[model samples]
Target: MATSYRVGIVGCGSIAQRHTKAYQSVPGFHLAAATEPNTETSRAFQETFAIPKMYADPIEMLQKESLDVVSICTWHGLHAPQTLMAAEHGARAVLCEKPMAVSLDEADQMIAACQASGTKLAIGHQRRFYPGWTEARRLISEGAVGKPTMVTGYVVDGLLNTGSHVIDGMRYVLGDPQPEWVMGAVERKTNRWERDVPIEDCCLGLTNFAGGAQALLQVDLTAYSSADHFTVQGSEGLLMVAPDSLRLISPDNSNGETLPTLWDTHTQSAAGSVGFESYFHIAYTAQAQGLRAWLDGEAGYRSEGTQTRHSVEIMMALYQSVREGEVMRLPLEEGAYPLSAMVAENKLPLRYPEKYDIRDPQRRTWIHREAYDRMRADGLSHPEIMATLFNK
Candidate 1:
């Protein structure tokens, strides 16, 4: 029998509940403790999970518990810092929530700290375990899609918020190729919600792969509902994949009948009844499987930090591309977040009036200097910088 791994969760939000349930389901894993800033939620989570210990602060929980595995399911900005803390506490494995971190530098720091501390760092890109997506990848590798020349996909939400899922899913299906470049555009006029995690109103981007494949992505924050769908095309076959279903189109049908596009449909469902909740179960199972494999020394976690950092970079490059009105290359220069810098540059639409007026002489100079540096770092031309400064 495998030895049990003691687990602790750093956040008590909705996603953390799923992680708690998943920990319980996985053999040789124990959800022993949790931490949350909110007392009411902390108490409730403790009661619900029967976790023996709970703390209002994550660092305190780490200091008190002898935990082997730590799950950081906090906000986008907190992932890196919390993971670093968990690693410092000697966690053998740290599973951080998606989008990795708000900036590339933070992602690098998390990876470095975990590597130095011998902690296995994984990101919460759980769709890697979806059976339909896995099947689609298999068929494509087996030439079902015959080389996968291009992919067109759409996500029903904002770019960094929900589009992270779409981007990571495509990266997985493409066998995790190195991204070459991205040419993109975004609108921040709408999608008034999600201020906590600022995102684009709508986004359209094309990311090219080093292996000569490309993916075109569209995300509309105003979409009716959340969705994950993609149509992959190749020389000989095609594939349509979503969260719950997979359809394959090939020239040589099993029936051997000649048709323009002969599709074979495959539907997926949970072991029990199927519904919206089923997707969460699937995600949790995948997380558990990854944890178990890494613990057993069987393989590296699929959504490991190094791999997820690429997605974060891609997401940032998309915004950088929009800001510069040109394609942005891979391995974006590290510093402040591109999205935040874009907002500072007044490149995206603002929902409300400026809270603080920069008209004060000192503040105006500082703000203008910051904008100039950001635009320069992005490689904007002098004329363009003048236009930005004078246009407003």
Candidate 2:
């Protein structure tokens, strides 16, 4: 018989909602409890998902609930401390959202805490389960793109939020190579924050993986806006990957090939992917399932903790490169978040000082969550919803 896992969510944001959706879809996973600071949002989440318990504090939730799996679906600043709390409380496993932590020190702390407590920890880079991505990795490994030389990723939004996925995803598709070094640059002409964490207006990074490929990334580095996609250049052919689609141009094929979106999960699962036909929206389900499998004594969890630290290290190393104004080598010495230090040192100061949070209006907090939810239910797009919220 498959074992049941009691799950608790630490933050009731849209990401948590998605997590709840994923949990409910999979069997033997209970919607046991959740934690959110805002009382109104807490109640809304509980009632909306039929969660059995809700708490005003995360520590309280961890202390009270006999949770087997705790999902850390909070802000970037909160991931490390909350993960530490979950580990201390003896959760069987923890599935933290991406970018793992704000710094290498915090990331290492979370890892050590979980390791000490005998708890399994994994990050929510669930997009690694995307069938297209998995197939791309398989094809690359089999030499479809012979000798992958360069991976160029383009993304918008902040590095920790959206860009982290691109960089990590690039690594995953590129056979998860060891990053030898990185050189990075940042621009912060306007005061900008993403989920209350200081961020750059735009940035670019170049990471050279050990003897394999060089990854070049541009985030929010366009005249007006950038996008989320990556291109792989190799000796034999090229491949382009996006969120919903993948295209390959190889020597064997004159015309480019667009891979199928859906694949046999049973076949893919044997190769460290999802075990079911779950895709995009339910990647959380795949991640949770992988954690469950690991707890059940299975090997080969894709988003395993020690492996994810490399992604965090690469990002932090990029920031450190910018801070030191030189190519920063891997196994970085800096433990603190270089961006914060750089800003504190009055480096990367604002040329236009009107401070703003890129996601301020998008957050569904106690105050303005109603109109946003309503507009969303009415089948409105994000831009449309934002227009209605602003017009109101």
Candidate 3:
């Protein structure tokens, strides 16, 4: 039997909970310690997970524990520094939450620190492990969908926070091709809850890849409802993976003959063919299993070096496009939107907005009015509409 690896978790947020669950689910892995800034929260997490040790500081946790790996589930801004600290302490591997860090320089520092220390880094893009998505890629590769030409997908959330997944997933499905240029538009239509937040609530972008493949991405935090829509359009067929189901439509009926319907007898003769519905739960479980395999080293997964750099590059490009009001090319120059620039400009609050002030009636009114206008434009106007409507 393989020796169980001792793991430490830093950060006690919701995502950390998921990581905790994943660790518990995987064999040859044991949750040994955890760290959080809040002493009470840290103690609570340790109690809840039956963790043997808890610390208010991650650096101290690393110093105290003999951990094989550490999962850095901290905020996007802190990912780099915390990851570097973890590596410096002799952790063999680090699994960091996505968006890697706020800037390329920070990402580079984290990567360099890990490389110098002989520690491996893995970015948490678990969606790549989803069964349906994996199956779709396999089918595309095997000529089930022919050559992929275009992809249309949207991640319904704020650009920096949730759009990271969409962008990462797109790259995964498209075989991680280098993007040549990107043009995007971001709209801050509502300032309802926290008018001071600087993050774009809605954004639409077009990406041109080096291989001639094109991608259309839409990300919004103010959606009326939640949705995960991914579609790949190939030369001879199309595949769509929605939040609940996977669908494939082919131009050739060679797979099997379709039955003629009385009301639409010409349906089968009209064109191609369609195939089965796949359950979401099955896909989710498959993703979990992939994480298990990666942790076990059953198969080599994409190194943290490539994934982190690519994700940060894409994010920076998106942000640049938004700021410059034009297309931004990749292979960003040395001075392009550095983290220092963001810090100097005081834009951190924009990316990580303060919680909405529910007690302030004026602020609530402003947010509601903005949401109402946005919803009305989207043809989903309703007084009782939840906050999700503006998210898509």
lDDT of 2: 0.80
> Candidate 3, which segments miss by more than 4 Å at Cα?
189-198, 221-227, 242-245, 253-299, 303-305, 334-392
> Measured by TM-score, how close is model 2 to the native structure?
0.86
Cα error, candidate 1, residue 230 (Å) = 1.5
- Give one digit per residue, the lDDT tens place, for model 3 in 218-298: 765333322345888888878775433457778665453222212122212221132322232232234334444565666
Candidates ranked by lDDT: 2, 1, 3
- Per-residue lDDT for 312 in model 1? 84
1 or 3, greater by lDDT: 1
Cα lDDT tens digits, model 1, 100-205, are: 8888889899999999999999888777777667667777778877888988777643666677887888888888899999988876643233425566556788
| TM-score of model number 3 | 0.76
- Runs with alpha carbons beyond 4 Å of true place in candidate 2: 223-228, 243-245, 265-279, 362-392
Point out the higher-scoring one by TM-score: 2 or 3. 2
Where is model 1 more than 4 Å wrong at Cα? 190-195, 221-227, 253-276, 349-392
